[model samples]
Target: MRDKVVAFVPIKLNSQRLPHKNILPFGDHSLSWYIFKNLLNVAGIDEIYVFCSDEIIMNYIPEGVKFLQRDSYLDGDMVQGHEIYQSFVNLVDGDIYLLAHTTSPFLTSKSIENALLNMLSGKYDSALSVQQKQTFIWYDGKPLNYDSSNIPRTQDIMPIYMETSGFYMFKKEHLLTYGRRIGFNPYFQKLNDIEAIDIDTREDYEFALKILETNKQIPIC
Candidate 1:
């Protein structure tokens, strides 16, 4: 049997950009619910833990899911995600750990399943969701490479990888040693922009709603 995998979702009510974004309803469910539900559905994921600060949000959580109130120090805006991830790692002892953000509502179970399969089969130390993009390269408000003559087509520019903040998987031991979801040896799983949406601002939340509405997948309940 495959080792049990524990998933920790970090959430907080306070947000400078979009307050209470996690509990905000996009369709029939809140943004956090979408992510939590997907995590529950993924194969090989043995447990799902919501490391949150708000108590009201806990009431809506489905039965069987675990909730861990975040420490005050880790609840601050300046706190890094690595700190919260490590805290949960210490609480739950699992073979593999998956850190997912509540803001990423577009993430699907299949995407998570594939990532897990790749990690186990490929023997990767860690894996993260990324967007494979290779558009015009720019830096510090200046175009670094505008001439396509020297470089290959945008599709062939070695595929610039951007962390989508969608999902990350790592071995428990590797995470504790490296103190990051991405361990020493990390692998990337590419996701489309639509599936990589992370709600940080009002504009982002609104955009996700539009996408779900257009697709007619918005939960009715």
Candidate 2:
């Protein structure tokens, strides 16, 4: 039998950068609702779990979505994403797990499908959505490069990739066995910066709203 694919969306209420951001409305619906709806539209997803601790955010959860009330131990600002992923691993029985965030509303079903397909191709133990970046990187007030004066064209340089906090896919057994989000090998699914935007501050929230208004169109859920 094929393993079922489950999506776990972890949302915490307390945010130092943007307080109560999960429940904040983007256009007409709460932020969490937008993500939850998108997950539901994906073709191969068997279950969608919304993990949250805030009552205000919980109250707005739409129908047809599973709600997992987060425990106090896992509801702190310092809690890592791996902790939340492990918590869901304990509660559910699925072969594949997809960890996503509520702050990124631009994640489309096509992107989700691509990530899953790439993970299934056997080239990687886990796959994550990332934004490929190319810029002069600095560390400790010093440039870290093989040739200090060689600032090649942005396109020529090897692009730096970052996990966009949009989505992650991994096998449940791999997570339980390794105690990590990814195993020995991980693959990256490159995404555009606009599609990878996550709300971390008031400025970011404003930017998301502006993007939504400017587009005047939300991708099909």
Candidate 3:
């Protein structure tokens, strides 16, 4: 029998850019709570597990969300993602895993569902979010995506993608092989500007709130 698809959220309380980022007030609930609630709306996910070492986040976790208490040592800001990700794959039971973060509030459930559908299409080994850029790109004082000899019109510039780290979906085998979130031949799904907003600084946090409120993306209860 094929195993189930699980959504994994690795959230930490410590932050340098924004203090107590995970549980900070983001609208009605904390930042983590907002994201967790959206994850619940997504269908086809058998389990939704949140791995955190902080006790404050425990208060916001509602039903359908499994809380995994992580080791305090792993809570250190210096702890890398791969270390925790490898542990998650080993400890969690799932054939496919969707890795999401609470900080990227713009990543809605619909985007995740679409990404998963594309991921399971069998054209790519993995899938992740990105932002499209269609401006003049330079590398080492040289033009990229344009021929220096025949500098094309600005409108004709080929677009490039910026990995947003908003969300990622990968098979267990890919995680076991590379010990990373993405694998070779990973598909990049470009997101709209609003959907690509990642909160790291105070400016970003404020901007995200504005976007959510202006668009009425906030869930009504």
Model 3 worst lDDT run, 10 consecutive residues: 212-221
State how far residue 69 of model 3 sits from its true place (Å). 1.1
Model 3, residue 94: C-alpha shift (Å): 1.4
lDDT tens digits, residue span 1-221, model 2:
66688988887777678888888887878787777787877777899888776555657667778877878678777888788888888988898898888888887877877878877777778888899877766779877542467778766776678889898888988888878777678888788766898888999999999999998966745
- Global lDDT of model 3: 0.80
> What is the clash count of model 2?
0
The most accurate candidate by TM-score is 3
lDDT score at residue 178, model 1, on the 0-100 scale? 63
* Per-candidate local distance difference test: 0.79, 0.80, 0.80
lDDT, model 1: 0.79
Question: Per the 3 Å backbone cut-off, how many clashing residue pairs does candidate 3 have?
Answer: 0
Question: Comparing candidate 1 with candidate 2, which one achieves the higher lDDT?
Answer: 2
Show where candidate 1 strays beyond 4 Å: 140-149, 218-221
